[model samples]
Target: MSNMNVIVEKLLAIDGALAAAIVDSNSGMILGSGGSGVDLELAAAGNTEVVRAKTKTMKSLGLKDNIEDILITLGKQYHILRPIDKQDGLFIYAVLDKSKANLALARRKVLDAEQALVM
Candidate 1:
């Protein structure tokens, strides 16, 4: 299994990774992070809302399925937010350059990292 640092580093190894952070959703706080193109602190706060909104919407819609991840695509970037199943109220946020990232592979890596991560 990987620790936070290792997980962040592994994420940075992705072809287009610009930044990555492990965030606490309950507090919108960043626990650990690596890489830098965007400000991770700000990203954490914004993504916290992203998670909350989706969760709230799901509840309202009466969808019983849990969210595995959320993807936000911009003109040049891709923001991926993945909640860690084993770590309650925590998530992995990764930003990638859309021009270089393979979305499928990046998502898979985040999933693997989540499994290996220790709360």
Candidate 2:
């Protein structure tokens, strides 16, 4: 396994990748970030709420599960938020250009990067 920096670097190499960050869902803090065309700080904070909300809703509904990932499709972009396994409260966030990115491939890349991430 590689460090968080290596994971972020690998994520940026994905086709049409715009930004990437490893965020602390518990505190909404960004541990590492890379790429451009987006404000990673803002994204980290906003997306933390997204993770919390979904988790909370699942608990309320009595569902025992984990969040594989959250994909938000915009008019021109794709945002993927994947919680890291074995690392509670940390997630990988990635943004891609909708027109230039292959959604399935990009999602898989994000999952791969998350899996390879070390502290």
Candidate 3:
């Protein structure tokens, strides 16, 4: 299993990756982060809310499903929030330059990193 730093490093190796972090959705805290461009700390906190809101909405609707990832596309960036399948209240947040990123490949890489993440 990979540690947090290792996971962040692997994420950075992906094309167009601008930043990456492991965040706790429960408290909106960042456990580990790497790379640059956007403010990872702020992003982690904000995205935590996004996760909470989505989960709440899902439960309200009684959707018997899980969120694989949340993708936010901006004019210049692509933000990915993937909840760790092995743990509760933790997630992987990755930001990428839209012009430089291959969304499919990036998503696949995130999934690969998620599976190997130790904590």
- Give one digit per residue, the lDDT tens place, for model 2 in 9-117: 9899989999999999999999999999988998899999999999999999999999999999999999999999879999999999999899999989998998787
Question: Lowest-lDDT window of 10 residues in candidate 3?
Answer: 1-10
Looking at candidate 1, the ten consecutive residues that score lowest on lDDT are 1-10
Off by over 4 Å in 1: none
Q: What is the lDDT of candidate 1?
A: 0.93
Candidate 3 lDDT tens digits, 1-119: 44999999999999999999999999999998999999898899999999999999999999999999999999999999999989999999999999999999999999999999995
In model 3, the Cα lDDT at residue 63 comes to: 100
Residue pairs with colliding backbones in model 3 are none
Q: What is the C-alpha RMSD of each candidate to the true structure, in Å?
A: 1.4, 1.2, 1.0
- Model 2 has an lDDT value of 0.92
- Candidate 3 off by > 4 Å: none
lDDT of 1 by residue, 1-119 (tens): 54899899988998899999999999999989999899899889989999999999999999999899999999999999999998889999999999999999999999988898975
lDDT of each candidate versus the true structure: 0.93, 0.92, 0.95
Candidate 1 positional error at 98, Å: 0.8
Worst 10 residues of 2 by lDDT: 110-119
- What is the lDDT, from 0 to 100, of the residue 94 in candidate 3? 97
